[model samples]
Target: MFFVDTIELAGLGNRSYLAGGAHTAVAVDPPRDLDQVIAAAVRRGVRISHVVETHIHNDYVSGGLELARVTGAAYLVPAAADVSFERIAVHDGDRVEVDAGLALRAIATPGHTPHHTSYALEEAGAAVAVFTGGSLLLGSVGRPDLVEPRLTERLARAQHTSAHRLAEELPDETAVLPTHGFGSFCSSGQAEGDHTTIGKEKAGNPALVREVDTFVAELLAGLEDVPAYYAHMGPANAVGPARIDLTPPAVADADAIAARLAAGEWVVDLRGRVAFAEGHVAGSFNFEAEGKVATYLAWLIPWGKPVTLLAESPDQLAAAQRELVRVGIDRPAAAAVGGPASWVRDGETPVSFPRATFTDLAKHLGDDVVVLDVRRDSERAGRHIAGSVHIPIHQLHKRLDDVPAGEVWVHCASGMRAAIAASLLDAAGRAVVAIDDPFAAAVEAGLTAVPR
Candidate 1:
């Protein structure tokens, strides 16, 4: 009885897996938070016998070490990974028998990372599935530029080859499960669905459909800016990441938060965009706990800085903490769950910002307000408001001084990035109006659209 289960980490747009025979299982490419994997194992009534990684991940911290430690499972990592730890070093063609009827064979599929590998789960003698990791995604191959700049082009070529190899070697019915490149920035392109088969990828994946040279050229051209936090991931994983601490951080009262603010530490507000805009602590930046707090907050926060989490409820704070730890941001310096009224009662005044619609901004187009576009370069390249200043939201923190002096109107394709940018600019004490509406509505509102 072979089984496969997917553990979706929505915020990071990645998935980990549990696959094995009825009595024993293997966990693949898990996030730093290990409880979910443990829960799945408990639910399945099986012991997690092996913890394997397809590669040393660049998008999030790997929980393989901690998971293996806690479960007493054998930690199987690619032989090529340069790590200072003890475990089974697996290479291509290496096979491990998990139990009587289940076995896993490592397949060398080096594209997403230099040492990246995929694993094939075999039930008896038949292939049950292939954990493709970052190699072959549902609709596209993993981007190879996560490593050094010199290796990106070479790795792109390898990615194309790897996808073809997996398609050629694996049966059509073999399940294809990948860890990254679904909607994650780790990949050059987005995958269409949650799950895929080897035959489906072989027939529809663009990398497999195109010539090697053409695939390489297009992949390189399509590569966007990697998150700034990616540089820390490889190093952290190589040296063994610290065990995740899910304990709620110490609660900070108003005076403590204010003191941290005066010391220039970060105080992130994980509330709704509208609620945050209506009123929030003067210095806290709103990240909306439901959004991509993992990617955005990890990208923006200064490394090793004291961070304080502020949310409207204990669940929101815990959820934010879970997302944060995925990207190696563990144990915030302090946290508090309350609303604006709680802070106000402590003799602190909350501030409010206006979240305007695109139609409202169009009315002031000719005024002294500067329209700031904070969407990605690829998004803005398709269609954007005419005469808008372009600065991708990820780079906005460093380029704060570059914003023109005036009342600034900010927006992204949707309201999310606009809200994030609004919080940032507001924290910097800039007069900002967040345009909270859909881009299609903006087009219908008579805002001039221009191509890049």
Candidate 2:
């Protein structure tokens, strides 16, 4: 009996699988582990026949190209998905055979994405297994907002229709394998940290349980915000790249990294925005972690040029390499080799953080501080301190004259983006303090403005 190996991505909390191998293997929605997928294929003495993406992935950079690179395998995407890679695009009822009597059929499952497809493996055209990518997670359905926005009525209509097709067309005994796991943002209703059976999913997954109208309504209403960068990433992925196997890039020390930055090479600080805000290599662009990391890095930063990283640790260099490869940004000019210490030791001018605790913030507010709220309008409207000036971060460059000028205190929800803005402002000859807690600082100053 052939068995499946489910490797949980502990950090990202998604699941990837190496299913049915000896002579041939197929990697299913590889979750940021190109080496692991290659190793599994090699260990089983199998040629990775195909690398399948469950959908246009949002959680991590897709490793379809990486797997295909290592094994000389075919990378396949859905026919209608707006992707641009050299992939075998298959539609409904199309089949890719791995071996005799072991073929995967692409069943067009368009809801989570317009081009989303699920696969069914059959021995002699009798289905034995199903790889439900994002369309069906263990105990949840994929959110339909990757291509569509805000889970509109059309999105609900599509989702409910997709679910109905899965529930009706598939067999009960078919082994259910999903691309996303408990912690993947693709699902909000997955079983508590465990994969769900398709039969069990049909019984319990909320998106599957409700009638068509209600199902769409529930799916639309419950989903949290998908990250902003994905708005650009999904379309770019439609075109394929040369496969990306994350062989680590050559490392360079802090001085080399600085030289690269000086030569107009983009320096991507892989730290959290808060950490980067507190201190970072000055003039480096801050691209924080989350879904669409590589996509955004590829989009925002210049490609084919050098990209040095300000990583968290030695272990994280591999992660940074993987992120770069996901969107085909593989080459680095130089990077921080011994972490941040070498840079501090070199005295290359550190970015200092003057972040204050709530008490420290309160003390400063009493000294005639002008509060600068530099968040989006939605963020500002939700829960902002009264009497704070509404100058969004993006517009801070042009609207400096609009902001009340004496001893200005700039703040965002957290302090990083605000700090960056404040630094830019400081260079422009403004007296600014980057405030971590704008609301508390505002109240402490006895600033008064009644709610509108």
Candidate 3:
């Protein structure tokens, strides 16, 4: 019996699969960090025979080419995906035998991209599973706007048709595994859980249930801002992503770290929000290593800017580096794995900022305090503090000058982003108070929220 091992990219909410037969396996939609995929193949005791990409990804760097080169696997890509690379260009209804009695039949499932393809796996001529990369996700389809704005509406309609095609063609029991929409922004809207079946999606997927025009309108309207780095991903993937270098980078001393900081490079602190708030480098930004470090840092940091990482342990530093590399941030300028106390021993004490809850911020509301809401436009539009000024976390670095000089109280839906914003404001020599509580607590705190 053939089985599929799902390798999850938690930060992006994407999944890659290693489907193994008796002696061979196929890798589906791998990220640039390919070691995990290799490990899975090794565990299954199967030689990776094929590396398949559903499309030219716009969200993260793909590992297909590198993985193929390393494993001697046949690299496979969609026929319509324009790329300057060597690979088997598969079209609709193309079947390739991966192992004895195990074959992958490519189904042209466009919409996520014009060339998007899904692979339906079969064992002894019976449908076993379908790897639906972005076209058909848990309960919502992949957002079509990532490719081109002009084609967004048309592609969305295609997405609806693609979801139905898969549901109609594949057996009800066939496992439906998706590469996007666990928490990914690539999803048209929210969906539940990590996995589902074709029958389950057919019965409940919002996109499949709605008319094409209605689905397109709702999907386009619901999309949040695409990450700035996404513009680079599609191009990088098309050419071929640079090979991931996992070798531990050099550790920087205080003087070198100071030099980068002085040069206006980003010095990212990967400690927890609480630890960072207690004390951190005077000018460093706090994006907790455990949270959405990849998504937020890649979105917020200036592209091609040097970044120095400060972490509590080697594991934390390594984890942060792995996340960064997946988004085409190949290397940090320098990294140190001890807290600020160890790194900042040159007579200058680390800085600390006050962290207030929603209730606390409500109590302190006055003329001298300026509430900065650092959430997405959708979040602000949904509901927010009456007088809070909106500048999403992604735009805060460049839009810092727009904020009036006062005691800036920063917050997002939760404390993580607030802590990050607070650090940025503090680094710029502004007085900041981070509100570290859930957004739901606003009403409970007696803070007036402008309802959506």
Candidate 4:
């Protein structure tokens, strides 16, 4: 019997897989933190014999190299990938025996990247599952524009052919397991359902049903702003990511925290938005532990700048550290485990901002208050308050002066991003109120204008 275990990186919106027969297994697209993958192998009582990548990832650092090193397993990468390290170069039609009666067959899929490949898990000469890395997702394929801009359209056309090739060649019952599309920005569109098969995708996936021209046109039209940190990920993966360090950072006393802030280093607070809004160290930013800390912090912070962390407890700091390392923010400069009181110097009062809802925003709509919409352009295109100033959260740090002068009321799809923006505005000496309510509530309160 063959078993597959999924390792979900919910913060980054991707999934990695571990599969094989009872005794040995193969890991596909593992994340930087190998502890979880190692623990999963222990629970399954299987020795991992191979670690493979579909392509050089553009989102998070791959744990494949480190995992293979630790397990003494063969590290398998696509033959066409221009990676620096030595790896077992996998090519089309190549087969690697995973266990006594199980093996993996490589299929060149080449759409998500020029060297992307899919691996089919075959048991007793019958294919049971296929790991389609970024090519064939649940409802859509991976975006093609992450690579060189000149190759985008060509790659989009390739995606259509690749999706069709899988559908035509694989049996309808072959399980289609993909590494992207759970909510990852790598997907061209929102993916549907938790699981799917070759038969299901043929019936509904856009890449399968639409003509190549139509598919490419629509895909290009719908692409949104790429995350800023993505520019660094691909190069890091190509050069081979170094082994990560997750030991707790040096504890920062209030004096050290103050000095770091004075030197322009980021002091991030990993607390819930509500607690952060109530109180926080002046000039520190809030990236809640309860939210997508990896995605947002990496996206917004100036690359290579020093960062210090403040968490309510030791466990919160540890968890946030794990999340940050996966995206290549390897080690925090310093960390503190306590509330704002302990993070601030003696006789200094922690800064604070107010939390309000859209209803409160409604009452002050026509006053001297500036309604700031920090959602993405795509999100605001759907609907927004008529006269609100727009700036995506990722761009806010660089464009703080673009915000009009007034008491600013900020909001996003949910209140998390609004809180982050609120903290930024607060640090800039602006009077800001975080709309700590859902955007749906804005419509209910009759605050949004017609959709553009």
Candidate 5:
């Protein structure tokens, strides 16, 4: 019997897989953090015989090279990927024996990238599962625009063809396990559900159902702003990512924290938004340890800028470190654990801001206040508060001066982003209030107006 184990990189919103027969297994699209994959193999009592990637990932670093090295497994990468490292270059129709009764066959499924490929795991010569890296996802396919603007439409057409080829070639029962959906920005659109098969995709996936031209056109039109940090991920993966170091960084004292802040280094507080709003070091930013730390922080911060982290506990600091490293933030310059009190200089009061709901905003709607919508351009297209200034959070740091001078009330789909914007505003010496409530509440309170 063959068993497949999922390793969810929830922070980055992707999944890796480990599967094989009784003795040996193959790892698919492993994340930079190899401990989880290594531990899963140990528990299953399976030696990792192969570590493979469907493509050079653009969202997070891959641990395939290092994992294969540690386990003495063969590292497999697409033959077309222009990677610097040596590995088992996989090609379409190439099959590798994984165990006595199991084998992996590579299938070219380009679209997510020029070199993207999928692997079908066959048990006793019958295909049981296909790891469709970025090609065929639930209800959606991987976004093709990540590679280059000139090739986006071409890739989209290829994606459509690839999805159909999978459906045509595989059995209806063949499990369709994808790596890039599940809240990943790599997905072309919102993915449908938790699980799906080749049959399910054939029945419902736009890539499979729609004509090539329609699918390509729609996919191109729907592409959103690529995360700023994504420009670095592909190159980093191509060069072969260095093994990550998760050891706790040097502890930053109050003086060091203050100095770093003064020097314009980001001192990020890794606490809940509410805790951060109550009290935080002056000039520090808030990226909650529990939230999408890697996605948001990496998106907003200037690349290569030194960062100092502040967490409420040692564990919180450690957890945040792991999330940041996956996206290639590597080691933090410094980290401090404890409350705002420990981070502030002697005799200096911690900075704080008020948090309210949309109902509160409705009550205070006036010229004296500037309502800021920090959601993405796509989100703001639906509806937003009347007269609210729209500036997506990712662009906020660069466009801070463009915001009208007034007491700012910031909001997003949920409050996490609002809190992040609020902190940025607070750090910039602007009086800000974070709307720590859902956008649906804004609609309930009659505070939203359709965009003109």
Candidate 6:
């Protein structure tokens, strides 16, 4: 069997596959990291005979259509798949012949997306492996609402019933393989364990172990917040034919980067919001690259326009490149010469971010001080200042409605996220100010903010 996993990092979700037997193989959901999948196939000495889309992915781009086109294989999806494709659409109780005897039987399992499906592989010489995509994960079922919207209840109902159906029908010994693992918004119980058996899932998975109604209710309650970009990826995947260039971009010098910006190109500053807000190339847009870089890259960067990554140091340049490649933006033009800090050595006038140090914030902690905390939920829950209103940096766009219009002040764990949040608010016509260091400011100013 040809086995390949995309090995998505924390918060990065994807599908992986195995091509069992030398004669034919299967590509599961087609990895966004196409090179990894192609390399794995080359090692196994088998051509891909099938490309299976377990479901329409929400977080990242799908490689199924492209992989099948290159391999000359049949692309397969569930009968209910809303995606328009030129390949075979397999349904429940339908059989797809793997080899002369090996078979992949479709099982209708819809929840995360309406068209979602899983397969029970029955091969004469191989151990039974159920390809459970978001149906029965290691410790939970897939979140039901991102793609389907207000019908979270409907999807949860489908998800609850489908998980139970898989648990009851599959053999205890069947090796359960899922598309996404821990840390993915697709699954709430993503961190506890990686992979498990059908029997193990039945025993431990919270969603699968509970009764249908209870499971649905629990799924609704425990649903992790979905990324804003998730709404944009579904329709793009279903229609097929998106222009994602697989090559890394051309590197440009400092002057060339400036020229591109002058020509109206977007600059994505990967440094945290504080670093960016404190000072950045004037007219450059802010999108922090600290965590979930690839995710934000896909969301912020449009197709065809080359990306110029504003890296902190040489250390982050490689990470910046890797994140760009994950979403199929193989090429990035170049990194700023000596970091954004060193750009001034070339005699360029830098834009100063209208920001304050922690001391400045402490001194100004007057009555009606609104400290907007833009860190993630975990960070906010652990410790926060007295007047902080929590709003994670990533969801700043959607959550902007709650911010008070008058003098909205921002500060994250560090200066970075705060700057990004403040920038967005400023763009949206809000009175925004940011603190470069919130913790240090609290201590210096003698404010009664809680400490870690």
**How does each model score on lDDT?**
0.89, 0.66, 0.89, 0.93, 0.93, 0.70
Q: lDDT of candidate 1?
A: 0.89
How do the residues 252-319 of candidate 2 rate in per-residue lDDT, one tens digit apiece? 66666667766877666666656655666665665554333454455444336677776777566667
Ranking by TM-score: 5, 4, 1, 3, 6, 2
Candidate 2: what lDDT?
A: 0.66
Q: In candidate 3, what are the lDDT values of residues 259-304, reduced to their tens digit? A: 8888999999999999998999889999998899999999988899
TM-score of 3: 0.97
Candidate 4 wrong stretches, greater than 4 Å: none
By lDDT, the better pick of 1 and 4 is 4
Q: Give the Cα error of residue 344 in candidate 5, in Å.
A: 0.7
Candidate 1 local lDDT, 20-119, one digit each (tens)? 7778999999888999999999999999999999999898999999999999999999999999999899999999987788899999999899899999
Residue 40 accuracy (lDDT) in model 5: 97
Q: After superposition, how far is residue 355 of candidate 6 from its true place, in Å?
A: 13
Instruction: Kindly report which residue stretches of model 6 are placed more than 4 angstroms away from their true locations once superposed.
Output: 1-11, 99-101, 125-127, 250-265, 271-290, 299-307, 311-338, 341-345, 349-371, 376-385, 397-452
TM-score of each: 0.98, 0.68, 0.97, 0.98, 0.99, 0.76
Error of 5 at 208 (Å): 1.2
Using lDDT as the measure, name the better of candidate 4 and candidate 6: 4
**Tens-digit per-residue lDDT, 1-452, candidate 6:** 33433434443654477655656778777655466677777777767788887887776667788888878888897777777768788788777777666778888888877878998888774448888877778777778878656888998888888887887888888888888765566775554656678888778777666877787777776665666666666766778745455443455566776787778676666776666666777656576666667765565455567777777766676666665554555667655634565543387766644677667666666746677888767566556777667877777766788886567778887665666677667656676677777565565666544554
Q: What's the distance in Å from true for residue 395, model 2? A: 9.9
Cα deviation at 156, candidate 5, in Å, is 0.6
